[model samples]
Target chain A: MSTEELQAWLRRFAELVHEHKDELTALDSAIGDADHGANLDRGMTAVLAALEEAPPADAAALLKKTGATLVSKVGGASGPLYGTLFLRMAGADTFPAALRAGYEGVLARGKAEPGDKTMVDALGPACDALDAGRSVAEAAQAAAEGRDATVPLVARKGRASYLGERSAGHADPGATSTALLLQAAAETLS
Target chain B: MTVGIVVVSHSRALADAAVELARQMLPGRELVVEVAAGTEDGGLGTDAMAVSAAIEAADGGEGTVVLMDLGSAVLSAETALEFLPDDVRERTTLSAAPLVEGLVGAVVVAAGGATREQVAAEAGRGLAPKEAQLR
Candidate 1:
């Protein structure tokens, strides 16, 4: 994809987040503090504003700045987790590599793994599809599938873990957001 | 100068109450301590920008040791450290210590003119006393 497409993907992801803010918050309210939507919305707003104020020179710069903006603005675990995703991606040479780096960064920051019912659940499967040389559309589909699968798994990380078995049956808000992000990338980049 | 302490919590009231307790426990010490807790909307969360600013404010040249309340507070504090200048970042330490007890212990150590490492060690050991009492 061209650098312009990458930028558009970011914009489109922001819009997707804005559109799904309430849904995300509702999911979070079931298992979290009910602020995921508002926090992500606020963070993405700052990201777009920063992009407009001082346009990044390249895709890497844009991704890096997006990470920094999220880190500074989005409070709680999502901020650092999502921020680490873009920050790690900024250094990669390929889209797949970038997604892998981003996924690894999330693991390192949150110490979550597949089936943990965190964002890693969706991001991990999406990256796996990408690594298998699948299309972005395929990866996005895998991400959505991963997100749906989390509804039956018990959370083992983050505040949701506090609920133990009770955390089952509720979709992970982070994973849902991750799916939204990948779906946006697939739609905008492809 | 003594080491400074910064408390990062998910609730502004929690950080403030912890700070108030530390100050009361170490009256007359005049230690430089700051709290960075809660989102701008006063929700239960932590902001790295607020954490970074608190660390800067708490620093008194002897370096600052940050105590985080829980999961995201630790992440935010780590992110805040990344924003600091190299020299300041090198001197700052993010303690895995329990927030309330750690802040109190760190305050006492800092008020005694302890170095950053010493204060961090003390703060990290704050839970030891309780653990021992339970034993």
Candidate 2:
């Protein structure tokens, strides 16, 4: 996607996060520190403001700035995790490449594999769909499915992991947020 | 200038308190101790940019050693390193120790003109006293 389209995607993601802030926080309360929604909302708001203050010259610069803003504002595990995704994705030239790079970045930062009941659970499937030449819409659906799949698996990463078997039955909050992000991309980028 | 120390935590008050406690541990000794904690709004969280700035500010020509409170605090500290200049990054280290204990140990050692490596070692051993006392 072009820089303009990417910026649109980011704005859409922020809107979605703001709209679902309470829901996201509720989900986090089940398995995390219950601040994901407020944290992401604050970060996204700052990102939008930053974008307006000093517009990025290119897609890479845009993503890099977004990453830095999130890292500085989000103030939790999600900060570094999501920050790394966009920062690494800035290096890619294609949508699929960007998704792959983003996923790899999360892995490096979080050290969580697929089925860990973390964001990787959703991000992994979305990247897979994108790699298979599926449309962004399809990738977004895959991400949602991946998030749903987390409900049955015990968490092995993040705070949810501390719950052990009790982590099962609750949807992974990070995975749910990942789906929101990919779905935003599908709606805006496409 | 001796080696510097940075304390990272999810709470600003906790970081500040830890620094205060460490300073008390080394009264009359002047050592560079920086704090990077909480979100911009002073809520519970960790900020990598703040951590990076704290590390830079803490640096007194000697290298800096960082001690973090929890999981994400560690991650933020690592991310902070990426924002540091290459020369500063090369000298910085993240100590694998508990926060309060480690900072007190690190500050005491650094106040004595210890090297970064030596400060880090003392911080890593900070938990040993408690462990021994429990035994």
Candidate 3:
């Protein structure tokens, strides 16, 4: 895929977030703070508005703009964490390398471990699969499996952590989202 | 060639919602946007490993960009970097823009075929103030 294609994919993803804002919030209500949907929706809405006014010239510039926007608009942990990912990716030169670097930035900022019932569980395995020469489809499948694997784990972070062992047996909304991301990638690649 | 995007966040619901919103806005755009969200699973908040994997998979020959939603998600993504090859690492870009502005910037750039630098710069622009206020 070309850099341009990658950018389009990101735009589509933002739109999807806007479309299902309500549903996502509802999911969060099950085991986390209800603001998940609302927060992301608001953030994406702002993103769309910015894009409408002026588009960037390159992938790095585009992502940099996005990072700045998120830092200013989004609150809580999500803002800085997400913002950092874009900032790092923008610094990168190519899509694959940028992704690899971006993931590293996420790990440095978020401080989460694998099997923690976090998106990391799915993401870590997926990266590993890709490294192993697996196709994007295969990697995505692994991500899905990783997401489902969270069902039996307990919550160790965020509001869900408050539930402690009670968090177990519940599918993590974040992991599920990660699975969707992989699916989207697969679709685009195909 | 089509491309894919990944939106990362602390909450899975938030990530899902972001994806849904993207779908609604650009129904005609030939791109795919995915979500990589962290859950309150017992181990940690967000899963860097999962996020890294998603990014790797999203990578078409052109590569992919990752947008994250705070805390451990970022940390996990960073950790996952070790697993990526140098070539893939070279293509990736990460930023710290506001979530909404960043998402929009990325989409617009992607749709328009802008470069990574351009997208990052736009994201830096953040949300504009109300027009009326400017006057």
Query: On TM-score, who's better, 2 or 3?
Result: 2
Give the TM-score of candidate 3 (chain A).
0.85
The model with the greater lDDT, 1 or 3, is 1
Please, what are the lDDT tens digits per residue for candidate 2 over residues A1-190? 6999999999999999999899989988887789989989998999999999999999999999999999999988999999999999999999899989989989988899888899999999999998999999999999999999999999898777787898888888889889999999999886
TM-score of chain B of 2: 0.97
Over the stretch B1-135, how does candidate 2's per-residue lDDT look in tens digits? 899898899999999998988899886778888888888887899999999999999887888999999978988988888789999999999999999999889988899988999999999999899999999
Candidates ranked by TM-score: 2, 1, 3
Which structure among the candidates has the greatest lDDT?
2
List, for all models, the DockQ compared with the true complex.
0.69, 0.77, 0.05
* Residue lDDT tens for model 3, A1-190: 4546655666665766667667666766777776555666665566656766788777777787676565434443454556666777787665455656766776766667887777677777777777677777887899889988998998787667888888787677666656665665666653
Q: After superposition, how far is residue B31 of candidate 3 from its true place, in Å?
A: 52
Q: What is the C-alpha lDDT of each candidate?
A: 0.89, 0.90, 0.65
Return the TM-score for each candidate structure: 0.94, 0.98, 0.55
Candidate 3 has a TM-score of 0.55
Q: Which wins on TM-score, candidate 1 or candidate 3?
A: 1
Docking class of 1: medium
**lDDT per residue, candidate 1, A117-162, as tens digits?**
9999899999999999999999999999999999999989888888
Model 3, residue B89: what's the lDDT? 66
Q: Model 3, range B1-135, lDDT digits (tens) per residue?
A: 334466777677777776666555565776656665654342124544456667777667555567776654555556446547787767666657666656766676666666656656665564554334677
Model 1: DockQ score: 0.69
